[model samples]
Target: MLTAVGVPAVVLLAAGADAQRPVEKPAAAVVAEAPPCCMELVAPAPAAFSAGSAAGGRIEWVASSRASVREARALPAGVAPEQGLQVKTILVARAVSAIFPEIQSIGGVRPDALRWHPDGLAIDVMIPNPGTAEGIALGNQIVAFALKNADRFALQDCIWRGIYFTPGGARAGGYGHYDHVHITTKGGGYPTGGEVYYR
Candidate 1:
C-alpha cells in the first residue's frame, strides 16, 4: 500500500538582486499528481487461468434490475449491463465499458471461494485477446481513461496486463490480470469530497 503526498514547488532567488526587494513565496503545495497511467510497457501477460474459472463460472446473463439499468445508463455510451451487479460496481464497469465495448464481460463479485473480491467495490472487465495489437491498444486506452478520471470515478486501484496503478504510482506485478482490467473503489461508492482510499 502507498500514501499520497503533496508536491512542493521551489523558487530560486537571484543573489544580491536588490537589498530591499521582497521575495515571493509559493502557494499551498498541491497533492502529488500520479504519473501518466501506463508507466510500464511490458507485453501483455499470458492468461494463467481460464476466464470462466477465474470469474468463478459462466457469467449470469439475466436482465439488470431497474435501478441497475438506470445506473448503467448514467455511464458513458457502449456499456452493457451485467445482471445482479451492485450500483457502484455497475458505475465502474460502465466507465471501462464505455471506453472499450469489445470487452467480453464485466465481472462483479467472485464466488464464495475467492475472498479478494469486495462485495460491491470491485469490477473486472474481460479482454479476450490481450496479446493482439487491438487488445493492447484497448488496454492502454482503458488505463489512460482511468488515470485521467481517477478522482471522478473514486478509483482506489486498477490492475491490467501485469501492471497496477495506485495514487502513489503505477508498477508492474500481479498474476491473471492479463485478461482483464480490475478496478477497486475507495469507499465502496462514489466518494464525497476528498475521500480516496489509495490516497
Candidate 2:
C-alpha cells in the first residue's frame, strides 16, 4: 500500500490492494564517459602524479555506484524485485571504486559522445596528457590493475585500443569479442585464464 503523507487523510490500500498505476523504474543515471585518449588500469595509481607528468593527461572516469553498493540494494525495503539490474549497476560502480581509486571523473563525459559505448564496470575518464610519454605509462599501469582485478567484480567489457582481456566468468558467448573484451566477475574477481592486450 502506498501512503501519501499529505494533509489530506489518506489510507494505503489493504496489503494486497491493486496498484494504482504501473510502477515506473527510475531512469538509470548517466554516470561516466570514456574518452579515446585514456588507457586501461592494471594496478593502483602512483602516490604522486609523476613530477615528470604534465597537465591534460589521459584519465579514467569513475561512476559512484560501480562498487559493491548493489548487494545491499538488491533487496531494498521499499523496492521491488524487478530492480535487480539497477541494483546490480549500483554494485558495479561500488566495486569499480573499490578496485580503482585513480578514476576520478566519470561524469565529465557528456551523454552525447562521438562514440558511446556501454560497459557494466567501466567509467569513462578524460586524460589530458595522453600524447606524452607519462600518459602512456599511466595508461599501462591502469591496464595492469584491470587485468588483476577482473575477478574482483563482473565486467561487461574492457576496451583498450591495442589489446584487452576478458574474465571467463560470464558472457563467454563472445558476442562483442571482436568489438571489445567481454568480462564478468565471479563476485570475488577475475583471477586467471585472462588474456593481455598490447600495442
The number of clashing residue pairs in each candidate reads 0, 46
C-alpha RMSD by candidate, in order: 20.9, 21.8
Task: Work out the TM-score per prediction.
Answer: 0.50, 0.31
Which RMSD does model 2 reach against the true structure?
21.8
Q: Across residues 1-199, which tens digit of lDDT does each residue of candidate 2 receive?
A: 1113212111111211111211222112111111111113322332233322222221122211122111011111111111222222333333333333444423211233432222222333333354555444334443443444443334444433344445432222323322222223333322242211110
Which candidate has the highest TM-score of all? Answer: 1
Instruction: Check candidate 1 and list the clashing pairs.
Output: none
TM-score of 2: 0.31
Residue 130, model 1: lDDT of: 76
lDDT of each: 0.46, 0.28
Total backbone clashes of candidate 1, pairs 3 or more residues apart or in separate chains: 0
Tell me the tens digit of each residue's lDDT in model 1 across 3-51: 1222111111122212121122211111122122111112233213344
How far off is residue 120 in model 2, in Å? Answer: 5.3
Q: Which stretch of 10 consecutive residues in model 2 shows the poorest summed lDDT? A: 68-77
